[model samples]
Target: MAYSERLAERIRKALTHLPIKEKKMFGSLAFMVNGKMCLTAGPERMMCRIDPDLHEREVKRHGCNTVIMGGREYKGYIHIQEENLKSEKDFDHWVRLALEFNEKLTSS
Candidate 1:
């Protein structure tokens, strides 16, 4: 399935002030900040790269689900249904979480 171009555009707008790049990964259009993947606008949902420590609480949020890939669960990545992104505020909230986490990452 193809990723959502519209959603990708919105994400682009939100991250415009940062040094970010767009790439195709996980069958989705991912937004990378400082060479790290911060978020992705997938075919049917938005993938948020948050703090792994918050996974248990975040997964309980509306339209959020555990991101399982290759039959394995990715602790820090969670999927947000399209329905949850109808509002720009909601969309930005997820983006903020992702950016916040990305900021905390140590430079390699």
Candidate 2:
């Protein structure tokens, strides 16, 4: 699966100050921060790693869906539709959420 360069660029700009590494993962472009998976840009969407405690609430938001694999739902990981990221605020929200979780992983 090919990823989106536009979205990838946006993410690149967002994490400009962070020690971020880009890698091909899950058939997408993944942003690894602090040596942990932070976010991923798919063709027309993104996967974000957030706080598991907030999963129930966050997934209820527009264009947000819990990441599921092998019939198991990954609470902290979410798939965000591209339509919901048309605005800067929404884009930033997802990026920040992923970064916050990455920070926690780094601290522990």
Candidate 3:
């Protein structure tokens, strides 16, 4: 599935004045900071990177889940369903988390 251009625009707007690079990954458009992935807007969901310790708390919310693939889980990386990001406030929740975690997430 192709990433959502509209969602990308919203992310750009939300993160204005910051150095954000867009890249292709996981069949979506990922926004990166300092060479580390911060957020991804896919066709069906937004992949958000945050503090691993907060994963359990976040996944309890509606439309949120751990990042699981091939039976492996990537802590702190979550899939937030599209329905949860319909509002600007909802989107900001993730934007803020991504920004905070970007500082802690090591760049590769």
How many residue pairs of model 3 clash at the backbone? 0
lDDT of 2 at 37: 90
Candidate 3 stretches with Cα past 4 Å from truth are: 106-108
Clashing pairs in 1: none
Error of 2 at 50 (Å): 0.3
lDDT of 3 by residue, 1-108 (tens): 798887778877887878889999878999988788898888878889999999999888899989998899999999998888998888889989988989877543
All candidates' lDDT scores?
0.90, 0.91, 0.87
Please provide, for model 1 over 7-97, each residue's C-alpha lDDT reduced to its tens digit, 9 standing for 90 to 100. 8888898998998888998689999899888999999799999999988998998999999988999999999999899998888888888
Q: Which ten residues in a row have the lowest lDDT in candidate 2?
A: 99-108
TM-score computed on alpha carbons, candidate 1: 0.93
What would the TM-scores of all predictions be? 0.93, 0.95, 0.91
Q: Candidate 2: lDDT of 34?
A: 89
What is candidate 2's lDDT per residue for 1-108, written digit by digit as tens?
699888999999999999889999778999989889999999899999999998998999999899888999898999999889989999999998898888888896
In terms of lDDT, model 3 sits at 0.87
Candidate 2, residue 53: lDDT: 91
- Report RMSD (Å) for each prediction in the order shown: 1.3, 0.9, 2.0
lDDT for model 2, on a 0 to 1 scale? 0.91
* Full ranking by TM-score: 2, 1, 3
Leading candidate by lDDT = 2
